[model samples]
Target: MTQVEARDSRGTEGSPDPESGTRRARVRRAVGALSRPGPWKRGRLLATPAALLGLLMLLHAHITDRGGLGSLVESMLPWFGVFVPVLLAGALWRRSASAVVALLLPVVVWLSLFGGLLVDKSHAGGDLTLVSHNVGAGNTDPAATARDLTASGADLLALEEITSQARGVYEQELAKTFPHHTVLGTVGLWSKLPLSDTRAVDIQQDVGPLGDAKSDDQKLPYNRALRTTVATDEGPLAVYVAHLGSVRVMPRNGFWTDSRDRNATALAKALATERNERVVLLGDLNGTMDDRAFAGITAQLHSVQDEAGNGFGFSWPAKFPVARIDQILVRGVEPESSWVLPATGSDHLPVAAGISW
Candidate 1:
């Protein structure tokens, strides 16, 4: 029990605990990390993906004519772009000054693409004014739709989904405004001026089971498109009124746009080969101009509403329009004014466009 033996025994019993020291060091390190800024790191992680998606959308619009997938992407991309700026702002909310600047990528993209669309209308000149409407297959009141269309005072009108049952009502109503008109299959046209050389443009191919139903009384739906020349104030303008293919959304099926895509291809091919330089295509199209299914039509003709309409201009359901399924498209004609008219007891609101050649 001497002093040296006592010290040695105490040292062995309570040597500086290596485990406790390591634990204390870890705690200090964690506290230091907590004191440091972290929001910026988190913000960068979120902002990068959003900024990239925004850029990809713009690039898609340029490199390829939007197909079905691209159109779906386009319609949704604007809302997505909105988040890019907001997320960037959030990244800066609790972080360093440099975080605010990170939003420039999305800011530039949004401004370059959508800013022009927001600007005040500048007059684009065209020679003739045209109107296009689907007129709705289940439209209960054809006369009302026709009268409303006549009131619009369009030089040329294209109608689609003109049911045989309602055809007479449309003709009777439209005859007062347009003396010259033509009806082929389920579509028809009325012109305040004159129309000529009417022909069915054969909008269908041997693709669907419905296509093979040749029986005169077969209760199957057949695909068809029509074309005619309207003698406008400008000149003879080739007017095509087409109901390409309807798209449906089902709970089980994602999106049914295949028929539409094929029909769009056919319509696009026909339009590309048209002899007339000044062409106008008007119809239901079963899709928005923003939709890729209408790329063939959009590529050939410019939407009057997208060019000149004031707002979202939704035209479906007549009562409330969520998406603009009805459209007025023109090639070689400048859209002067565009608007969706009031509903006329139909599922779709009548869309009108004033154009000059």
Candidate 2:
């Protein structure tokens, strides 16, 4: 019945439980705070769109062509893989689980498609060496470009877009290093070894009544393809030098590469019917190997750069190469190494590959 007893009756008992109750309250508050959403939620939500787009791009091949534009994008489809790294950086910065998971989709798809090309399969030595370049129709310094390519220590050189004006400069400059050279129309082949059985390759886009055809009565020879046999230590190697017609993605025209595509088809057929088993195609194809338009050529030959180069080895737009319009495809020969040479005055950087029998 004293003060202690009165306090106990009022539920404010003189006990050691107040501190424990306060501790339990603080623990509950900490648990509640820990259960709240984190920064990763924002990243996860933001990554949904990109993940969906990645899924869509995975089926780029299935996308129907819209007047030849689809093939252009499909040809560079593997380039989209570059975005995955940027996405990964964002995911890491935001501590995102969903973003990271989404990134895996593009990574897998890209690797499955082009991982082999990223590998370094080049050998130590090669028997034959070659270089290919589009020496632009408007190149300002043909002599400089010729010197640059000649310095590459290649056994053979194939040039595209050799204008009548600049062809002389190249011919004069290259004559010292490449003793054996031939120019057929705008395309030309210069080799250190002896060349024989050289001829102009037809590149007319005659579609009969369906498409327009122009007569070459003047024999001005706008032919953009050539073939020659180069006698080397490894025997005769049949080489085709070509410059496919340029393509323009005009607003009205929409992937206007009709002449280029037609020329590609003709070139493919010519390559298919080649009598020589050892063949090398070097030129500015104006389309990538991934393009179905080049199926005929690709079916018979393999890209040396894709097989033996260190990286993507892009060679167009010498200032900032984005794609490898120039190429070196080979058959019945082993590619030892492939690489992109430094830029010259020309619009395109030269591409080179080494091979052996």
Candidate 3:
């Protein structure tokens, strides 16, 4: 044997294989890698605010309705979903995994509650079509607005905030198509079909907590509401047109003060006692469907747009509708489809609903 050959044999004997040593080095490197702190720590810290906000929004329903603010807030529950996108944008800007995950809480909550409403249930036809608009008291051009409304081809038209000055303009413009119509106070119902039993329903407005008894002369002709029955081919459909008391948010005062709350109660009472089986209430309700004050009405009647519409049919502030204060609520009638019509001269966009049966 050569001198080099003997030395090589000795070095190789009882030592680890090259492949085995390589594996050991790799295991050490992996261990070191696992021990290092990653971005998770920062992600979790940054997600804290979003997590708390999401939790609050998730339980918005259970939030105390002590102040008028809670009910008002719940009216816009779906709007809380807007926060999710904002948070997601922040997460992307900060590159936070946990923040993005935290947003799922509100996203899931909003979708879980209102997901069905987002679906499009519109159909091609319906038995009856109605349009409800709050043609603002200060509408610039009532005749033009009336012309636009008449063009929609609605069978029944309910108009609120119908000022005495503009009433003739609408009546003259709508007279051709809507021959059978009744105007009782600020609200009026114009129908293509015959109407009966039309009267100004006493919503018992809040004159004052302690004041002299108001007589017919002392009170406005129709303070806030009216009811009538329309003779439809389907059957006699009870119709109500109303402009509920306005709600105001003042700096010193609070939201949805007791006046609107009281009017809601009176309106609910009138509706509960309605003699007709099939009824439709159309007007500027001054409150969203989510407002607890309207629970009495909502329990009996459902919003057509909410149950069977493509999207949020916000009708107030025609320029940029944010909330659907104007409403078309129905009972014993199946809503085929619901939608908001294009803006007119009024502050509110006209909302319509088609129903069957």
- Candidate 2 lDDT over 151-175, as tens digits, reads 9998999999888899899999999
Residue runs of model 3 more than 4 Å from their true location after superposition = 1-39, 207-221
The digit string of per-residue lDDT tens for model 3 on 1-357 reads 656533332247455577777888999999987886454544665588678766766676677765567777877777877877877887887777778887777777788877877889788689989999999988899989999999998999999998889989999999999989999878899999999999888876553222235332244445579999999877899999988766766454456446667777888899999978999999998888877788888988989988788888888788987888899999999988999999889889999999999
**1-357 per-residue lDDT for model 1 (tens digits):** 666533332245567667777888999999999988665555566566655765775675653432345655665554556676567656666573344555676677777766655654535444555777777788877887888888877767778888889989989888877888988877888887778888877666333233334422333354457888877656788888887666655343345466667778888888999989988788877776766666676777887776776665678777767677777787787778777777776787777777765
**How much does candidate 3 score in TM-score?**
0.84
- On TM-score, who's better, 1 or 3? 3
Q: lDDT of each prediction vs. the true structure?
A: 0.71, 0.82, 0.82
TM-score between model 2 and native: 0.84
Q: Rate residue 121 of model 2 by lDDT.
A: 80
Total backbone clashes of model 3? 0
Q: Which whole-number lDDT from 0 to 100 does residue 255 have in model 1?
A: 51
Q: At residue 120, what lDDT does model 3 achieve?
A: 96
Q: Provide the lDDT at 192 for model 1.
A: 78
Ranking by lDDT: 3, 2, 1
TM-score for each model: 0.75, 0.84, 0.84
Angstrom error of the Cα, residue 347, model 2: value is 0.6
- Where is the poorest 10-residue window by lDDT in model 3? 208-217
Looking at model 2, residue 61 earns an lDDT score of: 68
User: Over the full model, what C-alpha lDDT does candidate 2 score relative to the true structure?
Assistant: 0.82
